[model samples]
Target: MSQFSRLFWIEWKKLFADKTIRKVVFLVPIIYLTLFGFLYSEEKVTNIPTVVVDADQSELSRELYRGFDADETFGLIGTVPTEEEALRWIDEGEASIALMIPAGLEQNIKAGRGAEVLTVIDGSNMMISNTAVRAANTVVKTISAGATLKKLEAQGSWGDEGMALYTGIDFRYRVLYNPTFSYLSFMVFGLAGTVLQQVLFLGIALSVAQEKEQGTWQTSVATNSFFAITASKLLPYLLAGTLNMFIGFTLLLKGFGVPYAGSTVDLMVVATAFNLAVLCVGYMISYFFKDQLQSTQIAMMIAVPSFMLSGFTWPFLSMPTAVAAIGKSLPLTYFLDGVREILTKGHGLSAVGHDLLVLAFMSVVSLFVAYLIYTFQKRKTAGTQAESTIG
Candidate 1:
């Protein structure tokens, strides 16, 4: 074989030879995909427990209470006698939504005046809060329309015209990006970044540990250029991370019907750039820590917050401005945006050009900085060893 081909084969074999590396490479993807895919698959809000406090002991109030129970979206878990008890249910997580029918609700409806129904929703969980708001609005509108129709019928003026007059504008709701609002489609993009994070962490930690265990890291630094040593350490992981991306997108997403609408080429390009940037981060972390255990701990600490702040589950726009700015600084945010655009909206390269550019810039910057740090450390170590020999 040619010299370059022989070297490549040696490096590839070295990577596969480590039993721990082999197991992690094969298993991390499966664990992440299964956990995230199954947990956040269906987006439907079904059977959320809710509490209703009905102070208005009237037919209209009772009917409204019945309406909530009748809807499949909600289950009436308790009828609290007081507002404080209902609020307690929400605080304790026993209920997601609380309906407070004010004391004069029926009297106000009978007098041709509308009474405000207080809906206290738990906003701590954004998804549940959104679902609760939608359900509450729906039930209130239904009750109002029914009351209006009955009033019109009693006056002998009930007709299509009267109904139209009572309900002036009919609402037509349209959900963008994901028309079906499938959580899997939204989550798959985030999961891609998550898988990349795990792979990068495992690759870097194992690569560093393997070098230490084999004593190759010291031998290589003694014989080769610093640049060559860094490249040898980084290149393999980059290639492995790239391959993992293809496997994840093809097998878990496309094969499983995750509804990819965006340009596949664009998604691949952005994913490649983002993975490289994060891999550099992994290398930097490993360089600072001597052992695999410390590296793993640091990786977990960094990964969890980065994932949460990426605006995958909770929108960045809705967060506090300062918190949103922090999220924007993360590389995963751009990756998440680009992937979602492609998967759900079927966006083209041109549509997500800005995000791709940001990811590319970040990758270049991170790799350059990591190379500098690695080279500087190697030079420092060599200088110290030379001084010791001269002494």
Candidate 2:
């Protein structure tokens, strides 16, 4: 066989034949997908704990309380006498939402005047806050329509005319991209990508570190040119990462029912760039840390915060400037954003060109750095071989 083929086979064995590396490459990703998939399977946030502050004590006020109680998105734990008490409940973490009905609510509605219902939501957790706010708005709109219908009926306009008048301006809405607003769809793809990234980094770092620890790395560097060794070492990881990405996509579409609306070519392009960049990152880690354990530890340290820093769940600009800068330096940030645009928005490669460029840039710069490191090592290894031959 050719030298390149032999080096490829050697690297493949070094990566997959080892039990620990094999598990890190394959098993850990499966576990991460299963765990995070089930965690978000319910699809939507529901049953937010709520407190009602009803000062009116009127039948209309009670009816308003029933509106909140009937909403599946809210679970009314109890009623309180004052807004202050409800505020206390929210402050103490006893409830996520509070509904306040004022004393003149029934009087104002009967007099055909504007009545206000206050919805106070804890904004500490954005998911819960947004869910509670949406549910509250829906409930309030429904109740307001019912009240308007009753007033129109009392005025003897109880027909289609009443509905038309009540629904003035005809506010119709359409939800795009994600009609169901499923948390699973919103979260799963990014999470799976993050896991894939971490696993690939760990596997690459450990494989290189193991070679260095066993003193086999020098021999490989001594025999092959820098380009040949680099290609052979990276090829195994590139293939493995692509396979894992395929598995993740299958699980997303089949197991979790997440949609894939982009071109396969586009997906592959981004995946290839992301894989190359991540492998280079691992290569850098292996070079900096000589010990296998130290390299693995460094890999984990970088992998752990990558998702959070990737701006997947949170807005990138909303993060602290320093934090966002750190996130900008990581390849996962660009990869996840580009994948999301394709998968969720059904955008083509054109929409994600910027992200693709960033990943490509990262790959190029990192590969250059790795090449420089390899050249330095190659010179040292050649000198050692020359010295031994002379002796």
lDDT top scorer: 2
Put down candidate 2 lDDT per residue, 1-391, tens digits, no spaces. 9999999999999898886677777876775575445444555666778898889999877887898888877889999988889887875557867888878877877776777787877553456656766778787778778777777878898678765754211112223345455777777877888899998889888888889899899888878887787787789999999998988887788787777666766777788889988998887778777878778767876787778677676544345556668788998998887777677656688878888898888878877888888889989989988999999
What ranges in model 2 sit over 4 Å off? 1-175, 385-391
TM-score of each: 0.58, 0.58
In candidate 1, residue 286 scores what lDDT? Answer: 70
lDDT of 2: 0.76
Judge candidate 2 at residue 159 and give its lDDT: 71
User: Candidate 2 versus the native: TM-score?
Assistant: 0.58
lDDT tens digits, residue span 118-181, model 1: 7776543346556767877898788778877787788888567685745311222223345455
